[model samples]
Target: MTTVLWFRRDLRLHDHPALTAALETGPVAPLFVIDPPLVHGRWASPNRTAFLLATLHELDAALRERGARLHIRLGNPTREVPQFAREAGAQRVIVTRDYTPYSRRRDAAVARALEALGIAFHTRRGLLVHEPEEIRNATGKPIAVFTPFYRVWQTLPLRPLHPSPAHIPGAPGLDPGEIPTPASLGLPRPVDALPAAGETAARARLQRFLAGPVCTYAETRDRLDLPGTSRISQDLHLGLLSPVEVVTRARTLGCDTAKFVAEVAWRDFYHHILWHHPRVLHEPFQAAFRSLPWRNAPAHFTAWATGQTGYPLVDAAMRELAATGYLHNRARMVVASFLAKDLLLDWRLGETHFMRHLVDGDVANNDGGWQWAASVGTDAQPYFRIFNPVIQSKKFDPEGAYIRRWVPELRRVPESYLHEPWTMPPSAQEAAHCVIGHDYPPPIVDHTLARQQAITTYERARRASASEPPTQADR
Candidate 1:
């Protein structure tokens, strides 16, 4: 009675409920399907794919340490998973559940296919600390707002952590296939600045962060220049580290851990929102705002994407994302705000761009963050609350350390003019040896004017909606 353990996002061997369940039933055959749609999709980023491949290699090594091996197949999961399960002579397939729209459909199709083949299909909750349906309002409906959701989430209990099995009995005589390279997947070679990938690396990073940084995370998490934040997002995104392990470890570190835990809760909140409302992937979470007029300025978007926006902080953040496949959390908000509020562009465009470049880009979190910045989602920022890039720059990167690092043309500028170089007089620009619009391009859009335009646009949309009658096509 062998069971097939299908690995998707949950890449690690530790604290894996699905793997533990499969091992409990009988000897286990581990399988990973390289779904063609995902490997070749528009959301595909070479950095993320490369990191996943590296993590898979590490997973294989860990599996071999036990008495098992990971079998790899290339095709659609609906077809490939059942075929592989039958070939392995497995009676059941166990997998960790996923909440994305595509994943939900794929899993359903696979489950149906497996059923037709007389195989049992089971799923376990390992992606989040609690299942999406587990935490809801008093009425048993999913909570749409984060504050209330987080409040309810705090009251819920996490499942006890499951330790890795001491031995994983391998399904005998099965061929463990080779993990494909980026080139083999028709993707470009990954950028060099990606963090190391693997369960070992993820565990080490967690230990290091807990040893010191977790204590100051409350005060320093927002600082752009400091290495005060944990860079474990990619690991979590790839499931190299389990959320249970992360939360359980953070809780023991004392009061400062509350803020970090709250951040984790926010991740859960977004997943819950995404689980209940799948349309947020393409439209505004607030239905009334769906038809908000977006300027969709092309040249402005291109400047922002290429890191030539002339606003030092925004430019620095964009350049950092391009050079390395990661951006500081605080910088993410600033750039997102600049794109949506300042340039008056569509938030989806910025979201798509981030997914295209970020190594840790998860759909739920990315869409939620963009919508929050754009004031179009559940628990979103007030429509009138626009971020002033200059103010944010001076507050977070006060000494301009982050700005100077990525925007080298500003290296010679005085500290006074570092954040607002466009305001420098001709004489001051020459004295600093970095002339405005020459050494560094002048500000692409005036912050003052852009903010007003954004407010006006939102107001106009609100009025238009108020005057119109409800229609079935609103959603």
Candidate 2:
């Protein structure tokens, strides 16, 4: 009997444990089900959806080279997977394990459906270098803080890299269904063109980063004006590049790979958090900040989202996200902090907005990042530790090159006034062919005032939680 390998985020043909395991069983049939709810639902992104389609096409091409083609179907995986297996005469179904709340629920349903069909349902550790529950503390519980978790992650050894299967043994009599286009699926064309798709593009990016930029990654990663990042985050998100493969290759460079490798480890850490505390996706992980009095200033949020925040760095980052479906890591922190702290808006506001745009958006990483920015998660920054947008802009984007690139109106503004353009005197503003209120939106809220307000609000919530009795779970 054949084995059906159902692919989700693991879209690549290379370094796939589930695909390899499926082959070990007998002939293998690779399948991808385009779930409508996930593809066009509230959390759906045109950018990511388009990238996924292209990646899937590339995957089908790769499979054809291996004497097979990716089997595509449209519907719920729970119903479609079982039916597909029956058609292929597959006795077992295998997939890469996913840890998000929704993924868990979906997988549970899929497993039960397959069981009823008498097909073995199995998951392999393919997404992360280490499974969420694998790394443990002194007492064997999963570590909550990233530092300790990363330290433990380092000691855990990794297996050597293996090449893609020489050829995928095809299961005959399976139809390779229609590969849907974005228009057919009702996904809009993205404002920005997506990165090159597939395992080839992913590997090329990883190879280039490991070759050069990685040497200065530690020092230049935070720089806004340079291509300091590896830019393979989307690849990791779609499993075009495997986490272990990236890490193992980075270690071989013999440079200070600790920083670069830690970024990958951070992805693992966030996944672990999701696995242990699935509730964090919808609520504050720290619990006390669950009562944070977030504002309902839709206008402020609109301004921030459209890149008219009047803060150059924040504006640049937001516009970049809108245009490219990506953002610099430092800019992400700054913008997220501005939304939650400066604007006193809910972190979920920014979090959901990001999900709507980011190509690299992963549930675990995006949630972990938002919670960290809002100071409402495990090992989050303190409420008082708010970012001063002007300081961050000047320090990271000293020359305003990034701001100029994203916000063209600020192009003529002198570098001295670029970081805080509203501060420019009328004469200087006129001289630069820009006026603060007319040419650009003024700062919606004074950072100093907003910072104080955020601190007081967080302190109030902290006090309120302290006064309340602990839950039975806490006890």
Candidate 3:
């Protein structure tokens, strides 16, 4: 019996769980469905769509080298997959499991459709190093706290990375529709300098990173000016690289590398949180936090989105995100904190924006991070732990190099004033060849006032309902 391997986020052929299973079953039909519900869904962006299509093209070429090919279909997977299965004469379909409210529902619907066609549907854990349910606490509940979850995560033995198939058997040929374009979907063409696509590039990056930069990852991952973290976040998100392969290789390097491996667990930790508590997507993870009044001002959001916020670090980070569809990890935290705390905008607004722009954006990680910064998530930064943009800029981008890199108008400003350009005197600003309101936007909100307001807002909510039994919303 032939098996059809359905490819979703796990786009590559190398070290793929479902692909491996399908290969063992004999000739396999590889399928990719451009589900409209997914492409035009919330948090969707042309950058990710572009990467996906380019990656699919690369995947198809790789499959062709093995006498196999990827079949591209545009529509609902539940309706299209079963039809493809019948056409290919497949008796079973194997897929990597996805965890997210929408994905779970989609998979279930597809399974129901496949069942009626007399085809068995099987899914395996491949996206994460550990299934969210497998490495839980003693009470059989997923850990909401990251440190303890990471500690438990460290002890779990990892599965060996599966090798890519040397020769994937051919699929029954059929019409694989035209590859999608951004315009066809009413989206702009991606302009960001995205990472190279496909498994080949992913493996190369893994080898290159493990060889040189990983040793300093602990020290540098937090520095926005340095290439400390593996920029492989996008690759991992697209399944161009396997989490198993990444963890196993890093483990062989000893403690420093092991620390890097734990960061990978952070990805899983968020996924586990979302799987058990899907409501975090729509509501605050912390219940009391739900009561905090948010100023959903379009003008404020516009300034924030367009990088005209007048806050140097915040604007720089936002501009970087807008221009490249990527932001440094430290910048992500700082900017997120600024948005949800300083501006007092809903974390959901910032969360959705990041998801729309980041090529590496995953709903679980993005939502978890927003809630963390907004002080409404698992192991959230205390509400009082507000990040001062100027301080964060000086601390992380000490030389203001990252700021200057993106906000070039502030290039001539001295290091002391670059982080707080509004603090500069007119002469110093002129001497620096920069004007606060002209060359750069003025700070959108007074940091001092906003900080006090945010603190009071959170404090009042926590105290007023101190006796309210906390829900996952209060995470």
Candidate 3 contains a number of clashing pairs equal to: 8
Summarize candidate 1's per-residue lDDT along 1-475 as a digit string, tens digits: 8999999989998889999899887899999999887877868888888888888898888999999988999989999999989989999999999999999999999999999999999999888887888888889988888788888888888789999777899998887788999999999877899888899999999899999999999899999989888899988887888999899989977666989988888888898889998999989988668888788579999999989999999999999999899998889888998898888899999999999889999999999999999999989988899989999999999999999999999988889999999888999999888988788999998999999998999988888888888878663
Error of 2 at 13 (Å): 2.3
| TM-score (all chains, Cα) for each model | 0.98, 0.98, 0.97
Highest lDDT, which number? Answer: 2
Q: Candidate 1, which ten residues in sequence have the lowest lDDT sum?
A: 466-475
Candidates sorted by lDDT, descending order? Answer: 2, 1, 3
Q: CA lDDT of each candidate? A: 0.90, 0.91, 0.88
Residue 117, candidate 3: C-alpha displacement in angstroms:
1.1
User: Model 2: per-residue lDDT, tens digit, 239-259?
Assistant: 999899899888889688889
lDDT score, candidate 3, position 64: 86
Candidate 2 lDDT score at position 281: 85
Residue 319 displacement (Å), model 3 = 0.3
How many steric clashes between backbone atoms does each model show? 0, 0, 8
